[model samples]
Target: MTRALVVAAHGSHYNPGTALPAWRCVDHIRQTGLFDEVTAAFWKEQPSFSTVLDGLRSNQVIVVPLFSSEGYFSQSVLPAELQPRVGQAIRITSVVGSSAFFTAVVADRIQKALVKANFPPAETAVALVGHGTVRHLDSRQTTESQAGLLRGKFAEVHTAYLDDEPYVADLVRTVTCPNLVVVPFFVAEGLHTQDDIPDALGLSDPLYESQVIQNHRVLYTPPVGLEDNLYTVVLALANEYSDSEAAADPGLSSELYWTSHQLAQFGQVSLHADALCHVDDDVNAPDLEILDTPEAIRAKLRFTDSGEFRPLPTRRDLPHGWKIPAPGDVSRWAALQMIYPGVWKVERTCSPHEVGARQQGKYRPVRDISRKKVDSLVQSVCLHCVRHPSWHDQNLESVPGCIEPCSVWLEEAIKP
Candidate 1:
């Protein structure tokens, strides 16, 4: 029987780096050749929860939330969005953050940070900083649990929160330790880890590796979620669902076999005999860079023409004037995936009406908005996006269209 693994994560619309750890984990798992398919889905980004499972062909599926705590997202949002399938046997595993393996990973991070700082673990006080919410206790509970497990190994292990009582700033100011190490209990290094945490810790300089704060030699480590061995924790969480007895099918090949018709257009990108080109007519004529492989295409799309990082590929800001050679059907489909991840599968599985209904039903922010508000939001947000809501009506198969309202639009609609 075919098996699939879906790594669910809370991706960011604003910061692209927020989703890298989960994607990296997916790449590692895909390399193992254990599952027939491996894909990453996000709550706030593309290949969203609404469409992640739409195109899977697996008989058995396991979804592991790449969350650090059994908080609002992992406990409530994920289960609600990942609806039960009709024929497939789907199992949602406990979050990676709650796993015993993750606890060890955090401990390992703290130990390594201490050793690198040349501080003895016995004399160092560890501050486990978490993004807690006042609306729920799960975040605080998970943070305290990890701290509890490390109390004996360190001089003192204190749990602090960005949103809850005993705030991160308070802990940094009052913790009694000659040497302190702050470890962010986050899945990725986003604005929280890069700016908020550092600011709360009283570290003004962004480049400072270590600083003297309140007479304590403070050493801040990268977020625990960015740890290189996180794939092990993901595998450990899904171990029960993995079939050791079943012979593994060599997973989906990178070379996608597509027919000539399917290669004609990819949203705003078009394929030609000599090269693959952007369909947008308004883009300024720039020097066309030669991109031969899918990897090269992906690298080119990472930034805009002006060299600014393009976090969202669906945005209309796709840097133009790049040419990809039209080698074979494999290269064509592979290039489409690189340009718009999961769009081809989603287009095949869902109709325009189904996608529209999903956006209205699954996303409360989109559903709650008035028709006028939606029109205004769309004019402001969707107009600048490469994908269009009306593409289906226009019968523009080449123009990538939104099946459901994206997180960016939802965020705009929800704003007061």
Candidate 2:
């Protein structure tokens, strides 16, 4: 029998949001019976790239990155990891949730979101926010390309990023519209979703109050996450493999399985050990700002393994021991959108025209790319959702694959 494995992705550094979508995708695919097995892995955290290949039950593993664009992780990191398994009876194909074809899907979601907020194509400044990286130009390029497409399809669209040039604030300043709308082009509401973006715009946490920028002329919308539209995105990908013939390789499967198991086991052991001791007070604690830096977090943790963390502490809970907050607890991960409505058009009832009519005097529309291909598999996905809407719930929670953030250890009482 041929078995297929589909892996999902998010950027990681012990952040649940970074790894949650990947795990959720794997579980969703498996429940639909579209693949024999599906396993989720990450660029950071547990089930490292080195270990993911070890746990494959099928000779064919289809790795799908959940990221919206081609960047370092997709271009450099993913390719290097898969190179070793090239001809070893294991084949890997890269598929992702959102890609070039997703612009239309996002455009649909954006228009709906704007309409509900009483935003118009004329005075409304549509800001496309992305997590741009200085390390790779592709991050900004992807965001820029997507914005250009949106401008083509709709009027008054502007592009911005959390990093690099043409910063978000600068881009938003260039829009001539009296009112502005910011849409985060991210997969989930994580650190950037919860903290960085809002901080950049001078908005408060639990950002519900719609305040005007430079005196009520500009408005910011809550982020887009967990919308029913995402369900549509997921369905599109699963349908791609529903009819493909499965190719099996027992030897390859065993190797992948053992490697993953060992890596998971090692991670657990290291966590246990790290949990045992308090941070040495003698060392200067890293500033709260540095926790966002992965290398800084790694250096401060004082891992005994010389590279990673040690085992978890067996004690009930040490006064000096570090306890990382659950991803769900991060103020950054909290439901900031719930406090604010109209982030997604799903629950709101407002006509697109009625919302934008107020600002309908001056603006520009951007061209959008339409590249969606519907196949027989898409029908299969529609059927799956019809039969089992609850399928995603099973994987919606955080997975065991993520490594805890270094913040937990920072909270401990340091000893000299």
Candidate 3:
């Protein structure tokens, strides 16, 4: 039996930061041994809301929404896809906005800002900036309600937005305090939180990148939902349900990922290569063959067992500043030398070659350890793996916004 957690949100198709905070929380929670599998999905991004549930293996899945409001997307759109028409153990948790704990998290951030930035509540006013979309009245309701929670501590509480009146820029006119603390009421730090919010306020520096904006003092803080304490709110929501009956084994097929980065650290190839890039089993893979001229190298066996990220169209000549450092194949060493003779070198084994001529071989059940010596001998350097067949073979057409850059050397795929 197995259990899984899905952290669902609105992610970016272009910007990675848009969905990172929620993904970061999902990853951190996964590490605590609460679930066997953890994954993330977004409405505007890859592994989209339309297909997020398909990858889940656990019959008992706890899905927690990372959104800031209980809007149409959360109440209707998200539930419609997840709620079973007949029966299933899948449970959906509350959005972060409804959690009173989230309000406290925001308050906690305000208190910290007052301490670090030296702006006490007696002198500083807090402005909670939100999107406040005019298309839907419910969008601004949470931002308006959350202000009541922080009113007692601050000299004055101001609520502002980008689309509605009393916009983010108008904060300069509405609040009279000499010191103002601005906290973005967003789920993640992306274009709006990091770039647009600053530009709207006529700020030269990036969002939350400084304690003070311009000459006059103003404390800028990151998105509120990303506060560490909010993880408690998520766990609490899932724990509300009673324990379920035992589940069946998750016999799901997993795709393999590769990267030299992880292979260098552990001196083992199989255990860590999944860190580079991966995709769930759905899309059909194209026939892939790794060949040098008419001959395929022995290293090709590593890829034969599993696929890699998007494959390159035609091999580009090695970039000037980059080299393979150690090409794992002894057969390819000659060809690599033909291209750039001094680019790579093969390390010799530390065997008693001079004393004895006898050689013997035997089958090893756990071959993962046998490759360690070769992996250690090879000098692995960073390569732009996005184009290689190894990258393309995983069947992912594009990288997700929330996923960190792939480091293939780590078995756990994501690297900060």
Best by lDDT: 1
lDDT (tens digit, per residue) of candidate 3 on 161-257:
8888788887866667778888888888778888878777776554454444444477788888768777776666655542642332345222211
TM-score of each: 0.83, 0.55, 0.58
Off by over 4 Å in 3: 83-87, 209-216, 241-416
Tens-digit lDDT string for candidate 1 (1-416): 77888999988766767877887888788778777777788987767876677656677888999988888887777776676456677788988888889987897788788778898877789998999998778877878888888888888888888899889888866778788999999889789898998988888664337778889999999889888899989987776766653545655444332243444556578776555778863223456677875446766886788987665677877777777766666556556656766553225333333434444334554444566776777689878876766522443354555665666766666678
Instruction: Tell me how far candidate 1 lies from the true structure as C-alpha RMSD in angstroms.
Output: 4.3
Candidate 1 achieves a global lDDT of 0.73
- Quantify all predictions' global Cα lDDT against the true fold: 0.73, 0.45, 0.53
User: How displaced is residue 213 in candidate 2, in Å?
Assistant: 1.6
Who is ahead in TM-score, 2 or 3? 3
Per-prediction count of colliding residue pairs? 1, 33, 14
1 or 2: which has the higher TM-score?
1
Model 1 stretches with alpha carbons more than 4 Å out: 84-86, 243-247, 250-261, 270-300, 320-332, 345-365, 372-380, 388-399
Cα deviation at 81, candidate 1, in Å, is 1.5
